[model samples]
Target: MKKILIQQLFITTLMLGLSHNALAEDKKPATDSTPRQSTMIILDGSNSMWGQLQGINKIVTARESLKTLLENAHGNINFGLLTYGNKKKSCNDFTLVSKPEDYDKKKMLRNIRKMNPRGRSPIADALKQAAKNLPAENAHILLVSDGEESCGGDPCAVAKELRQSNPGLQIDVIGFRDEKEAQLECIAENGNGAFVVADNTERLKTLLDGVQAKARTIVNVTGTPVDGNLPGSIEVSIKSTHTGGTPSRANFSIYRPDGSNIASFTSRIQVKEYLEPGEYRVKAQWKGQSYTNKVIVQSGKTSTLRFDASQSGMLRLSSLNSNKEAVKANYSVYLANGDFISRHVHQDNVDLRIPADEYRIKADFDGTIQEKNISIEPNVDNNHVFRFE
Candidate 1:
């Protein structure tokens, strides 16, 4: 009898221990297995933000719209703030007021409201500075500006350089109260982003809402398995055919079967996302070449897509007068078969990426057409100078 009682006590102790461990496991917090996205907002604190629209202060409108965006972005996105021309009249007036932290809405909104626009707009330098604060991949820069670059910096060139160096960084521009600023659009185009204009308070709020919605999509995990591995997913891989490696820069724009955009993200080599089981469209841009394809995803499975960049070379074209000094000229790129590719104006130096082949460039220096034929090799930077007599 004593031996049987001892055995029963041992069994009961073991059962109690197991039940305690099970309870502890159930109380643990759930974790998400997705990479977080980071964004740095470059606010245009230039004097123009203080301008008035319909008796409403532009700065007030910006602050209010940002407040709404921050409120909605709470707990969903990581945000940082960089501002220029807020305190003084110097070209180097930009400051990183807030570093990107996980959903710190209150701190970011406070910094935005305290901005006092009083100085010049060093847009180019500001953009470069903003890029430094972001991650090398899966990051964004939202540039809100009301005027042009007053500090003699080429914002377009800087934007292109930023994208080239950090292939994963996207630069978006919001032209507040100004629509005729072509340079702003150039900044967005070269930075692989969008340009939108807002002239009034209500419009500014609505536009900001749109931007925030896109931001959410960017930061949300797209191609990972869910808790139970029930949702479908897709992974994309980009590489170069010449080196058989990832290209220096590439852009991916994913769309639904109904032609609506799902997400536009940049990656040096690869990206993944989780979604519903369906057919999706993917458009990839690299080295001035674009390729589109379709992908299908099924439940509890991952669909893999691959894109290879063709052997392409870069042509740096410039024009000079009889004095060997740079001058404004119209340039056009054409294939050897006389097929036109594109055109540009007032670009002292333009970089054109073309497949490895023969090409012809025409430069119109104030109506005097100068033509030159050249050959481009794979992964080479070919420079050509058009000297007008």
Candidate 2:
């Protein structure tokens, strides 16, 4: 009996030990979050977005979506609003309905209600302007667009350029009954964001409001840490080589990880800055150019973070007659989102860092032949090649 009792006790102990071990194996560890990111909402007031559906105009549905987005947003998340309906020519046309601040249900809803659809879909211009509303902190842009550019501008190209300029910007695009829905997908993928489509206004409202809530929450920034450390400050070395024409004189800023101004390097081909620890945003001129990389500073450790910028991508235009490659082809590239990457072109390759997703590439060879709907993938450095005739 004593032996049996002892054996039973041993069995129980073993089982408990195994259970603990299994629990340890199955348990997932928690990660550290770096505070929060900022979000900007650009609601499309284009006429197409105003189409009627289910006894309501799409613009009305968009308003409801804005309300939902507002209601769902976290109390701390900041958001700004810009409307484009009545005016499309001037950056002043799209008025700042609101700057990124706390959630204001009444204000947001009212702004939506006040939006009158009357202007063209100047998406690229709107996006470029919207960038001003957002701080250089970890930020995202949720742009809702319907139809392609009635104004005949490339929103997808704008998104691609912005993304290449800053790999950190998250651009989420929503298409409401867009015949050109495919293009917006390029914008989202390249911008490190998602592209969603809504068949109706309710869905659009639900998605936007819900997504806005997520955007309003706290955001932590992440990136490659510098290998080494310097006690006081770190040196940032940048080399920008423009493949084509001479780069225009430009000025931009970089914010440290702590959201502090670490260094202000003049916009030039080569420059350097002394920075402290934290994430930083290096803003270049509006000429639509920039790239990202890192260098580390440690008390006792010396490390270097290497970043290379070249216009490369997974999407290529093939079947180029040897003649096409022989001479410079003036071309512009467009991503899926209603954005324009290149309005003007060169005969050879233009280095645009596209997103890591499937895309539709459009090429205007010699400004006469328009080749549209070319599929592309991200991680484009060497995975793809272009041959255009």
Off by over 4 Å in 2: 1-34, 87-92, 200-389
- Please write out the lDDT profile of model 1 over residues 1-389, one tens digit for every residue: 99999999999999999999899888653346444457788888888888876677778866766677677553445678899998899998988887665335667787888888889989999988877777665677878777889999999899889988988776767676455467776687677665555553333443454444444444454743232323445667567756657444577777877767765656434444445567888777676765466899765455789876667788888989999899989998777776555688878888877667788889999889999999989889999999997
Give residue 74's error in model 1 in angstroms.
4.4
Worst 10 residues of 1 by lDDT: 223-232
Using Cα atoms with residue i matched to residue i, what is each candidate's TM-score against the true structure?
A: 0.49, 0.45
Off by over 4 Å in 1: 1-33, 200-389
Worst 10 residues of 2 by lDDT: 224-233
TM value for model 1: 0.49
lDDT value, residue 174 of candidate 1: 67
Best by lDDT: 1
